[model samples]
Target: MPHIHVRHYPRNFTEEQLRAIDEAVTAAVTSTFATGEDTVSISLEPVTPEDWDSQVLAEIAARRDELIKAPGYWNES
Candidate 1:
């Protein structure tokens, strides 16, 4: 099974956009891991912008090296 979790700021995306995101994420995971789209699971987590640093960025930074796809914005020196 391939599980994908996407975290983003609340109210930034519409329903159609989220659906597109879910489709794209499913395609990516299925292609990358050779898994069926039916077996892939995607979860979208919405967090407030004010809590982004502590809720998302901090966790990603702490495990940066372990991330398969790290955000480019966080890679700037």
Candidate 2:
């Protein structure tokens, strides 16, 4: 399973806020999947917005049409 990783910019969130978010995520995932809390782990890594954008771009390039359909990929043109 892919790890749940969160990247936040500097000075964006407090430690308590981050912990709350992490716990909320853990609860949501564990509730839906019927898994142990240990199985649903979260990692908080701080990074700039540009880096996060780049990661999204790279992910799109890698998955492209297989995971994301273009305007008319499914329908006959």
Give the best candidate by TM-score.
1
TM-score computed on alpha carbons, candidate 2: 0.58
Model 1 lDDT vs. the true structure? Answer: 0.84
Q: For candidate 2, lDDT tens digit of each residue in 12-38?
A: 678899789978998888888888888
Where does candidate 2 stray beyond 4 Å? 64-77
Error (Å) of candidate 1 at residue 13 is 4.5
lDDT of 1 by residue, 10-64 (tens): 7667889978988888888888898898999888788999999888989998887
Task: Give stretches of model 1 more than 4 Å off.
Answer: 12-15, 75-77
Question: Distance from true position, residue 7, model 1, in Å?
Answer: 0.5
Q: Cα deviation of 24 in candidate 2 (Å)?
A: 0.7
Q: What are the lDDT figures for the candidates, one per model? A: 0.84, 0.67
Candidate 1: pairs in clash: none
lDDT of 1 at 61: 88
